[model samples]
Target: MPAPPPPSAAVPRRRWQSRLSPTLVRDRCYTRSFHSAGLRPAAVPLPDGAVVHLWLPPTAATGANPLHPVLLLHGFGATATWQWAPFLRPLLAAGLAPYVPDLIFFGASASPAADRSPAYQAACIAAAMTALPSAPQRYAVVGVSYGGFVAYHLAHAFPEAVERLVLIAAGVCLEEADLAAGLFAVEDIAEAASLLLPQRPEDLRRLVGLTFCRPPRFMPSCFIRDYIRVMCTENVKEKTELLYVLINGRKLSDLPKISQQTLIIWGEQDRVFPLELGLRLKRHLGDTSELIVVKDAGHAINREKPAELCRLIKNYIVDPSVKYRDDRKGSWKNAIKRFVGSSLRKVDSSRPLL
Candidate 1:
């Protein structure tokens, strides 16, 4: 009763057990994955005093492969490592050198500048890439969710450097009015920010539920608390500012369509940024872009459908001519069957099977 037994002496056994963080364990696994894929972490300091942290290929200087340098940009919630670790080995197997970066205000990357626009993020990324030793003249960019916004702006800002584009579950076509019109479950940007940058365990759970089509069966409360403490607690003000700048007052009319051949991948069951936005983006890009809907996935397609996503990216980036029909309603194979059957009725019956 008197002073509650000094602070350190009163620590509970359960509290001590919670200190063995699952978040830190998973983070170590992510680091191991990156290292196994031959990627080493580096920090690139910009002229504006911001430092961009990246996982760079082993052959960055001497034996760099100019033809297959690919930049991977992650979304909100976690660092680039957590979002992109699953992709490294597959990309390397396809002979593509993957460069993964943590965008400003997330992970180890941070900027001192006041500008929080996606365009500024894009410029910082471009500058970091340019500063690399023996940097490739051109590289394909693969952006997921919020990363897609930055990727789109990067392509728009540096057309000469970005050769191809891949956007997954990104709502670049979304406008501020869409929020007012109820395109999202959240009522407004403030609610959205709270959900994204969660401060409480329940909020993190809610975010995970919205992000994954099949959320994990069980997540320990301690793990959630540890995650929120380690991942979501830092740079809180700056991260919130980034979110406000991303969604506030944005307009489709002001969005520029990139000239690069684009591959847009969306989750069929995405609730965060609906499939309607993906279709709108395709229509806005006209013939320059192709839309592919990953079946049975939600907002977290990278986690939910990593194999399929990697396959799509590899096929598109390695050879753009390898076309994949949109599988929105059904499989592309069924579409081919329908097309072939329709064409057969108009053909001569005497035609040979050969």
Candidate 2:
């Protein structure tokens, strides 16, 4: 809206070797729509004595043309204000209606109270939602990054409430030791991995690699820095509350039980949560769910490829059949395209890749 507050820092460029392909160029169109239309924030009270920072649809919302309130959930360290802005315009344009809320510990939401836990946070989100007054009865959700993990649990944990599910860079659980080393630590991913998930390394390493189709050299330092800030900003007084939320937020074993319609999208060239993971998630979710790998998306598709993502999102919610088929066909097309592009570029640059 208002000229973006000057970027916290210059955006880091991908080494020529780490560039995205032409097909991944879905929505490079840029506009100032969202800056002028940001919604006012509201407070959502929870049963556990916590308060969440939420932005509600205009109360003057018209019933004859009321938009469905889309609840957007944030990632592990992100706030509502920081995470959902990129997708807001498309959501608004789609006319499905959307609401962005920061969980208790992350955004403007108050820090955790005595009973805070991941389940407690989830319950708080559920409770805050019940207080909203929007209609046209479409219960659609879109979660970004780690928020995707919560969306998964939310859909499964409260199946009757949500009608559609949108997972962006959705996260899954690992034994800690299984996580990828590149995902954490300000300087050294391996060292950070060892410290954060000492007991479960392999799973974490694989998970981190899955985020990207290919990892970049000299990784985006600025993103990593901002990421560190988000993680560190947690209400320190509620350490246990934040920790609990991180450790137990997702449970993939329960994915098959969710009856809500689901849609999954990832940047095909994403090094954060690779396309293969999206493929596996597709099979596990079955024919009812849809998955698309945003051609050149990294972990932040809304920021990098906002236009295409926005269009896909709008179609996914308003035109269900179209999105479902697009997703089914899209993932396959994008992956093959990414593979070919990588091979060509690798050959041209004389870069070594797997």
Candidate 3:
């Protein structure tokens, strides 16, 4: 018997600990939730050596009794699964089939192409949809934060395919000058990238503080480090490039509004993009858009108020006639009252016929 060989020095103790990390456990829960919602993981390959990893319904491939399709694009901080897991079950329950994809360089999705613009991301997604068997001819799109930028481009580039749009805490209306104009807390794009793509525990903490109205009371440093290791370290260079591309020279005048009716949900307390950006987007989209402000919520509205967010999404997607108060002027409460009252009226009017 060869006595005890020396323990391999290559693997650090931290690496061993990460194998049993709580973050991993939570990620497994997210996976289970996705599976329970009848979504399966797949990779849709594009001609440009990019692979988009998606969670598709069983019906997407077979086209049997297909529900309305809704494409979910995730934000910059984490992969599709991490950002959109809370949305899966709620969306499925609302009779909307979710097509959740990890944008390039995130999760299992990757592209070797040099292009990093949102338009490129949109093109990849559009191509993937076209290539998928029995894909929906038209579908709704929901984008959050960074995902909103991509979703906007997708709708603009393929209006025929995108029937409706929803943007949550996405600052697609922001101009490149906004950063220097004191719109954001960060002084410049590099600072924004550092916070968004945190490499250290403190950086993650700052991001969480800005993102959540009430961040975790006690997030241990070890867990933060573990999260950064698992979620933030994979594509640092590319993600940094993406951040620069997103804000470097963007201008509001350059943004093209889509014909699709849009729903803009923002957190009243959002510190990242700020609520003003949501209002700007509504103004840009004009009568085709409605804005909803979730009181007390912050940038991560999906996580902070998942139930409310889901309700808004279901109402907007399931019923084409659903409309909120005009963007001209209305308090949040008034808008909610009008929305609820109209929904009640519709239900009452249909009850007798049913």
Tens digits of lDDT, candidate 1, 1-354: 556666676577546655587877788899999988888888999999999999888778455565688999999777889999988888888888888999999889999899999999999999999998878889999999889999999999999999999999889988888765656766578888888889998888877887778889899998888888878899988888888999888899989878999988888767778767777898899778877877788888888999889988988898867656444444423323433533221122121100
For all predicted structures, in order, the TM-scores are 0.87, 0.66, 0.88
In candidate 2, position 311 carries an lDDT of 75
lDDT of 2 by residue, 1-354 (tens): 557444443333332312342211211111123235545556866665678777665431443444555778876545675566667666766675666777766656774366555555667777777765543344688887667766776787777777788888764532232232222222233433332332333433333443434444444544443334334434654644444444432345534446777888777665545455566577677776777776655665666767777777788778766645553346644565555533222221122111
Q: After superposition, how far is residue 206 of candidate 1 from its true place, in Å?
A: 1.4
Q: Which number leads on lDDT?
A: 1
Where does candidate 2 have its weakest 10-residue lDDT segment? 345-354
lDDT of each: 0.82, 0.56, 0.82
Worst 10 residues of 1 by lDDT: 345-354
Stretches of model 2 off by over 4 angstroms after superposition? 1-35, 59-65, 111-118, 133-138, 173-177, 180-231, 236-256, 323-329, 332-354
Error at 125, model 3, angstroms: 0.7
Instruction: Summarize candidate 3's per-residue lDDT along 11-33 as a digit string, tens digits.
Output: 66656775779888788888898
RMSD of 3: 9.4
